[model samples]
Target: MAVHRALAGICLLGLLLCLSSSPAARAASKPDYLILTLMWPGSYCASTQLTEKCCKPTNGEPAADFLVQALETYDSTTGKPVTGCSRSCDFKILPLVNMLDDLYTYYANLTCPSNSGMPHWKDVWCTYGTCSSLNQSLYFDRALRLREKVKPLVNLGSSGIIPHATKSYSLEDINDALVPRIGFSFTVVCTRNYILWPFFYDDYLSQIRVCVSSDGRSIIGCPNGRESNCGDTVKFPPVSYPVSSTVIELPSGDEMAL
Candidate 1:
């Protein structure tokens, strides 16, 4: 009887170890929510300094709209980014070739030392993409599709929040315009206008962060809640480009890669 109990204990321990070490277990350990970060081109360019290079794509200037910045995975419990899942990045461009046109149009690299936006895409894939349950192709495809579904420009414009050089809109109005249309709350991010230094320091609408389910299909309320540093009123500036490339060090952070 004692021998039988010992053998049973060993068997149960082995079974537990096998299940815990499986691929499914590894995937389950990852975060189950994603944040789709969308950046407004007008605000991005307007916040730039003369030293900071903000160029239009060689192909042409992308539409005056909100561009896909990143699709980041975040911990639902702690509301922090999940990264460095795989030690080996193993990023390849071949799988993303078909989507290059849409990528360039919607997610182009505006900063100086620009290539085909591959470096930026590669960085994102290696960082956040590897952390998700998606391959390189599926990750980029998902972000693009989400951007299409959340037609931010159309949603905001319908609410009479189109970009203007001199016009400013209240933060409340901006939230009201987006939350109902998106079916979920989002974080309104803003950047300080460096162009108008000490004279008139104003915040410009920079990025909108919408949360999505792990499957990357349905929009979900951000676990982090709607957080913003925007003032009472924020400007929505017009998009413009420098004829010559102005050079400055690129900003760091997963969201500022664009």
Candidate 2:
């Protein structure tokens, strides 16, 4: 009985030590809001290089849909997007292996197709999760949890925002269309491309980013009147798979090799 009591005490001390050492255990001046950036695969693939492997259906993925690009936070005081807040701890994604299947298909880093394209999730976790109120494990788990809560893609798709077509949609019309489901102020950013030379054309419907509560529970209002880049009447064009010769650097210091 005495030996058992001593062992129990030792275990408790180890656990306490771990908690103290982890950033999530310590108090932090949390960010004002979370910016959930959802990437439209059609837009992403359109821009992705041919060398990069795009996210595929985890299990007969119904459609080439939206991917969670960056689950970031906005610093109200600094007026800039928060990134690389802390790197004191090494990121270990082994624990997240259980969700590997879903992560690859849903929030993929098409730039890095290796290891089922987990680097995308890793980049976001290491850069932003360290600064979050939750720990490493809970941070990712929360993202997955938050994603399951909304059905914006389906809602938008049902509202005639389908793939392989171009149509002009007004801001008010989109706001009303999504308010019923998303129930929050969100930002819809679009991408434009010009054929160049003899002619020029532009496209839209690149991304739809939504703001989440700090606690990661509810989809909240757009912070500081954050507005979309599109005009009052915007074009919703089909996703383009444009191959870029230049590589872009991700927030986690990762570069999408061209």
Best TM-score among the predictions, by candidate number = 1
lDDT of 1 at 48: 57
- Shift of residue 186 alpha carbon in model 1, Å: 0.9
Q: Which candidate number would show the highest lDDT if scored against the true structure?
A: 1
Q: What's the TM for model 1?
A: 0.78
For model 1, residues 1-258, the per-residue Cα lDDT tens digits are 999999999999999899777655544656789999999988888765566567676532355678888899888876688776776678776676677667877877777765556677878887788898788888999999999988888888989998899999999999888877787557889987655567677899989988998878878877777669898999999777544433322223432333
In model 1, which runs have C-alpha deviations exceeding 4 angstroms?
A: 1-29, 48-52, 58-61, 194-200, 242-258
Alpha-carbon lDDT of model 1: 0.79
lDDT of 2 at 88: 58
Per-residue error (Å), model 2, residue 26? 17
